[model samples]
Target chain A: MAETGQILNLRRYRQLRNAVVVWLTLVVLGAFLLRIPRIHILEHTARNLYFHVPMWFTLMAAALVSAYHSLRYLQSGDPIRDLRAREAARVGIFFGLLGLATGIVWARFTWYLGTSLWWNFDPKQSFVVIQLLIYGAYFVLRSAVEDPEKRGRVAAVYNLFAVVTMPFLLYVLPRQMESLHPGAEGSPAFSDITHPIMRLVFYPAVIGFIGLFWVLYTQRVRLALLEQRVEMLQATMLEAKS
Target chain B: MKTWLRGFWAIFEKDIKLELRARYAINMLLLFALGALVVMAFAVGPTPLSARVQAALLWTVLLFAAAVGLGRAFISEEERGTILLLQLNLRPGAVYAGKLLVNFVLLLALNIVAVGAFAVLLRVQVAWPGLLALTLLLGSVGLAGATTLLSALIARAAGGRGALLPVLLFPVLVPLLLSAVEATRSALLVAEGWATAADELLTLTGFGGAVITAAVLLFDYIWLD
Candidate 1:
C-alpha cells in the first residue's frame, strides 16, 4: 500500500490550506473595501465581479483538474485517480452552484430590479446551470455502477464525455446568443469594460477560490483513500476469520 | 478492414431484422413523435407561431422522442442478453458504429414523420425545403452520435434505466440542439440560400464529427469492461 503521506503531502496540504484561508480573507476584504468607478444600475453590485465570476473560474479550473485525473485513471487504472476525479468534480459542482446562486442574486438586484425576476433565462446563466446538471448526471452515473473498478472506468468515460461538452456550453453557444453577460454578442468584452484596478483583485480572487477548491478537493480525497483502506482491511479480516 | 466492415454490417443487419420483426423501438419512436406533434398543435390552437418558436417546438418534440426510443439501441441488447454475444464477436468500434447507424436511421425517420406532421397540422410553409431536410439530416447525425454511446453506458448501469438516459444526454446535446433549432428556423423562415445558416451548419457538422470520433475512441473502454 502506498503511504497516505506519499500520496498526499500532508505538510504541503496544511500550508496551502492556511495560505488559501488568508489569501481569501484579503480577497473578500479587498472586494468590499476597494474603490472603483461605478456605472449606472451596477453601482456597488459590481463588487460581485470579485465573488461571482471567480466561482465560474474556479469551477472551470476544478473541471479541468477533474477531467485530467479521469484521463489518468483510464490510462493507469488507479483507484486513487478515480477518487481524486470524483472529489474534484464534487467541489467543482459546489462552486458552480455558488456561482449560479450569486448570479441570480446579482441579476435580481441589478438588471431585473423592478421586475423582481430572479431568472429571466439569461443565456450565460442558463447554460451554466445546464453544465451543472451534466455534473449532476455524472454523480448519478457513479452511484448506478456497483463494482468499484467498473464504476471507476465507466464513470471516468462519462466524465470525459461530459467535460468535452463544457467548452461549447460555456463559450460557443453563449456567444451565439444575446446575453447580459460581458463578452457576449453585443456586450463589450471583459477586458474592455473592466477597470484595470479591478483586475488586481479579480485575478487574485479567481486564483484564491481555485486554491480553496484545491484545499477542499484534497481533503476529501484523503478521507476517501482512508475509507477505501479501511474497507480493504475489513475484507481481509473477514477472509481470515472464514 | 474487410472484417471490420463485415462485423459492422452483421450487427446492423441483425438489429434491423430484429427491429423489423418486433417493431418495438420504431413503434415507440413514431408514436411518441406523432403524439407530441399533435399535442403541440392542439395546445397552440390557431395561433400562428413565429418560425423560431416553431423550430423550438419541433426540436423539443424530437429531443423527447429520441429520449423515448434511442435508448433501446443498447438496452434491448442488454435485456436480451445479446450484449455478451456481441462482446464475444465484434470489435468495440464496429459495435459503436453499427449502433450509431441504427440510431441515426431511427432518429431520421422519426424526424421526418414529426416534421411532416408538424408542417401539415400547423400549416407551416417552409421557405427552403431542401435546407430543412439538410438540417434534419445533420441534426439526426449529431443526435445519434451523441446518444449511441450514452445508450451503451446507461444499459450497463444498474437502475434508473428510463430516467437516466435523458438526464445524462440532454445537457451534452445542448450545442447540437441549439444549432439544429437555429438552422431549422432559418430554413422555415427565410428564403435565403444556405449561406445564411452556414455557421450553424458548420457547428452541427463539427459537433457530430467530434462526438463520433470521441465515441469511437472511447467505446472500447466501456465495451471491454
Candidate 2:
C-alpha cells in the first residue's frame, strides 16, 4: 500500500484528460471541415480515415501497454501491474470494437453500396473480429479465476500470449490476402490514396484518441484500487470485531 | 538432456498406458470427429465441391474436433488430482513435451479418421498425397502446441468450461489455419503442386516452430504458478 499514492498521479492524469478532450474536439472539427481530394467510392467518407484508422492505432497502442504491464507483473508479481494490464486491455477492446463498427459502416457505404451486405468477409475485417474475440477471452479468463492474485498471474500470461500472436493477425496473414483496407496487395497504400493534409489531422487524431484511452484506463484503475482498498478495510474491521 | 528425455518418456509411457486401459478420451474424440464428419457429408450430399471448399471443410472439422477433445489431457490430470503429484515429480518442460507429444499423436489419429471419412464421402482426388501428409503434420504441430498450453491454463481457472478452450485457441491459430487450408487445397487441386504451395508450407512450418518454442518457454510460468 505504500506505493498506492505513487501508482497514479491524479493531477497529471487530469491535465492529460483535459488536453485530450480539447485535442480530439479540434481533430473532429478538422476531420469534417478540411477539404481533401475525393476518390471514386470514398467521396466524403474519406473523413473516416481520421476517425476509423485512429481507433486501430489506439487499440494497438493499448495492447502494447497491456502486454508491457503483464510482462512486468510476471517479473515482479505486482498486482498493480496486473490491474493496469487488465484496464489497458479493457480500453483496447473498446477501441477495437469501435474500429470494427466504423469499418463495417465505412465498407457498407463505400464498397458494398449497391448490394445489401454489412459484412462480406473482408480479410482485414475478419481478422479484427478474431482479434476482438481473443481479448474477449482474456476478460473471460480473468473472471473465471477466483483469487485476485491467481487471476492476475493467469490473465497476465494469457494477455502476453495473445499479444505475441497479434502481429500475425494484424500484419502477416492480412498482407497475404486481398484486402479492402489500405496497404494491402493491389490496394493503394496511405501514401498513394491519402492526401498529405489528411495526415496532419490523422496523426493528431491517433495521438488524441490514444491519450483518451489512457485517461479512461487510468480512471478505471483508480476506481478498482479504491474498491480493493475498501474490501481490505472491511476485512480488517470484521477481524477486529471477531 | 538425457534426464529430460527420460522424464518425458516416463510421462508419455504413463499416458499411453492410461489411454490404452481407459480409452475414454480417444474414444470420445474419435466418435465426436466421426459424428461431425457424417453430418458434414450429409449436409453437402451428392454435390460437387471445389478443392477450396473441401480443404476448408477438412480443416474446420479438424479444428473443431481438436477444440472438443484436446483439452482432456490437462483437464483430466486436474480432475484426477494427480496434477500435484506430477508437478512434484517432473520438470514442467518435460511434462509439456510429453503432453504435447501425446496430444499431437491423438490429433494425428483424429485427423486420419476424419480425413479418411472426408475423402471417401466427398470423393476427394489427391494430386499429391505427400504434400497433403506434410500439410497435416505441420498443421497438427501448431494445433497441438497451442491447445496443450491453453488447456493447462484453462484447467486451473474456475468455471473454465470446455467451451472456453476454442474461444481462446481459434484466434491464435488463424495464421496456421489459413496456411494449412491453402496448402491442403493446393494439394487436392493439383494446381502448381509443391512449387506454388511452398509459401504456405513455409508459413505453416514457421508458425508451428514459433508457437512450440513459445509454449515451451511459457509452460514453466503456467505450470509453476
Candidate 3:
C-alpha cells in the first residue's frame, strides 16, 4: 500500500508539474500575441475573442461531462458516478457564470456603457441564468438529502433532465428570438471581417480553456472521492471504538 | 390489451378518488389560476389587449398554476407515504400513466380556467376553438410528462419544497413553453392561418411524445432507488 501510494503521488506530481509549465508558457505566448499595438485596430470587441469564446468552450465541455456522468450513474447505479456528475455540474456552473461575466464585459466595452445593468433579459442570457438556477438547485437538493443513495439518484436524474434542456436554452431559443449577442446563425467570428491571424489564437484559446476545465473537473472529482473516503474511515473508526 | 387499459384506468381512478376526498390539489390549483388571472388583469390595467399580450397572459397563468399543481401532486402522496403503497401495488408504468392522466386532467382544468379568465377579463377572442383545444392537449401531455418525472425526482430530494420544484421543472419545460406559446399565439391571431401554426403544434406533440417515452422508460429506475 505504501509503495503504491508513493508511486501514485510521484506520478501526480510529475504530470501536474510539467502541465503547469506548459500552461504558463502558452499563457505568456498568448499575452505577447495579444499585446501587439496593431491588433487594437481589430476593434475593442476583439478582446472577447480570447476571453468570451474560451469561457463558452469550457462551459460546453463541463456540461458534456455532467451529461456523461449522469448517464453512467443511471446505468451503473454507482455513487462515484453521481459524485463525478455533481463535480461536473459545479464546474459547469462556474464556467457558465464566467461566460456570462465575460460576455457582459465585452458588451460593456463594445455596446453598453459601464453604467448598464450587468444582466439583460436577452433570450440567451435568460436561458443561461435558468440553466444555472436549475443546477444550483441540484446542489442544494443533494445537500438536503441525508441518504446517499437517494441523493445520488435524484441528482443524477435532475442532471440528465437539465442536460436535455441546455441545447434548447443555449441554441434554439436564442436563434428564434431577436438578440443582440453575436453568432445566432454561425460561428462568432464574421467571415468577411475576421483576419486569418485571429483564428490562430482563437482556436487555441478554445482548446486551452476546454483543457483547463477538464483539469479542474478531474481535481474536483478526486477531492470529492477523498472526502467520501475520509468520511467512511471516520465512521469505521467510531464503530471500532464503540 | 383490456388488462392494460384497465390497469391504466384503475391507477387514474385511484388518483382522482384520492384528490376528490382531500380536495386539496385541484382546489388550490383552480384558486391559484383564478387569482393569477385577476392579478394579471390588474397588472395589464386598461392597456389594449393585443392578441400576443393576451396569449402571453394566458400562458403565464397556466404555467404558474400548473407548477403549483405539479408540486402538490406527488407531495401529498409523499407526505402520506401513499407512493410506497402504490408502488407495491402497481407497476411503475401503470403508476406513471395514472399520475400522468391525473396531471393531464389537472392542467386541462387550469387551461380552461385560464382561457375563461382571459376571455372575460381581457376580452380576447379565440378564433378556432378546435385548434386551440388540440394545442392545449399536446402542450398538456408534455407538461404532465416533464412534471411527473420532476416530481419523482424532487420527492426524494432534501428540502424538496415548492422552491426546488419549479427550479427543476422550468428548464426542462422551456421547449414545451416555447412551442405552446407559438402555437397559442398563432391560433389567436386572425390573420395567421392554421397551416402557419402546424409546425409549432407538431413540435409540441413531438416533444410531448419524447418526454412521455423517456418518463416511462426511466420511472422504474427511479422507483427502485
Candidate 4:
C-alpha cells in the first residue's frame, strides 16, 4: 500500500508538472501580447507571429517526430514505437490544419481583402494542403486494415515515403513557383531588416510551441498505451476463465 | 548489377508484351487523349490560339492522359494477382525500374500524339523542336516517376486503387506541369534561345531526380509489406 501510494504520487507529480508548464506558457503569452505593439513594423502582422508561425514550427516538429518514431519502429518492430508514430502523425495533422486555417485568415487580412485578390494559388498553400491530404490518406489506410502487424508495417512504410516529399513540397516547389509566403530568398526573416529584438521573442515562440506539442504528443501516447494494456489484460482474463 | 538489369529487362518485356497483346492501356489513353482534346477544342472554341491557351491545353491533355494511363498500369497486376508473384521474383529496384520504363515509354508516345494534336487543333507552332523535345523528355520523366510512386501507394488501399492515385498525384505534379507548360509555351513562341525555359527545365529535372531517388530507396520497404 505504501509503494502504491508512492507510484500514485509520482503520477500526480507528472500531472502537476504539465499544468505548471501550461500556466507558464499562458503567462509568457501575455507578456508577448504586451510587447507586440511596440515592435513598430510588426504592429499589424504581430498577431500572426503568435499564431501562424508557431503552428508551422509545431507542425514541422511533429512531422519530424513522426518520422523518427517511424524509423525506430521499422528497426525495432516495437508496437510502442508504432503507437508513438501514430500519435505524432495525429498531432502533426492537427497542427497542419491549424496552420492552414491561420494562414488563410492572415492572407484574408493582408492580401485577399486588403489587396483585393481573392485567391492567389500560392505554392506554399497548395503544397501544405497536399501534405495534409497525404497524411489523411495515411489514417484512412490505417483504419481500413484489420491486421495489426500489417497496419503498422504499411503505415511506417507510407510514412517514410511521405516524409521524403516534405523537402520538395515545402522548400523546392515553393521557391520554384516564386511564392509570396515570405522568407524564400529576400524575405524580412532572412534580411538585415529582421531586427535583433524580433529574434529574441521569435525563438522563444518556437520553443514554447514545440514544448506544447511534446506535451500533447506524450499524453496521447500514454492514453494509447493504456488502452492497449487494458485490452491485453482483458484478453488474458478471458483466456484464464475459459 | 547484371542480374538486376536482367530482372528489370524481363519485367519490362513482360509488361510491354502484355500491354501490346491487350492494347487496353494505350487504347484507353489514346481515346481519353482524343476526347480531352475535343473537349478542350469546344472549351477554347477557336480562341485564336494565344500562347497561354495553347500551353494550357497541351498540358491539360498530357496530364489527363498520363493520369488515365497510370491508373491502368497496376490494374492488370492487381486483377491477376501477379503483383505478388512478381514481387517474389524481382528485387524492388528492378520492379521500380521496369514499371518506370514502361510508363515512360507510354507517356512519351502519348505526349507525341497529344502534342501533334495540339499543333493541328490549337494551331500552336513549335519553333525549336530540339528544345521542345528536351522539355518533353524531362517533364515526362517527372510524370512517370510521380505516377509510378503514387500508383504503388494507392494500390493497397480499399477503393484507392482507382481514385486516390489522381488525388495524391495531381498536387505534387503541379510543379512539373507548370514547368512543362511554360517551357513548351516559350518554345512555341520562338523565345530567342533555351535561356528562357532553362530555369523551368532545370527545376523539373531536379525534382524528377529527387523523386526517383526517393522512390527507388523507399520502394523496397513499401513493397516488403
Number of the top-ranking candidate, with TM-score as the measure: 2
For each candidate in turn, the TM-score is: 0.94, 0.96, 0.89, 0.85
Which lDDT tens digits does candidate 1 get at residues B87-117?
9989999999999998888988897789889
DockQ of each: 0.65, 0.62, 0.57, 0.36
Model 2 gets an lDDT of: 0.86
Docking quality level of the chain pair in candidate 1: medium
Clashing residue pairs in candidate 3, if any?
none
**What is the overall TM-score of model 3 with all chains considered together?**
0.89
Model 1 misplaced regions, further than 4 Å: A1-3, A170-172, A237-242, B191-193
| TM-score leaderboard ranking | 2, 1, 3, 4
lDDT of 2 by residue, A1-242 (tens): 56688756778777888999999999999999999887888888889888898898888898889999999998988789998998998999999999999999889988899997898878877877877888898998887878888788788878877766666555456645667777777788877877889998999998999888988998999998999989999999999999
Off by over 4 Å in 3: A1-17, A24-28, A31-42, A111-126, A179-193, B1-4
lDDT of 4: 0.76
- How well is each residue in B81-115 modelled by candidate 3, as lDDT tens digits? 77778777677788778889899998888888778
Give the chain A TM-score for each candidate.
Answer: 0.92, 0.93, 0.82, 0.82
Error of 3 at B164 (Å): 2.1
iRMS (Å) per candidate:
1.4, 1.5, 2.1, 2.9
**Chain B TM-score of all predictions, in order?**
0.97, 0.97, 0.93, 0.95
- In candidate 3 chain A, where is summed lDDT lowest over 10 consecutive residues? A1-10
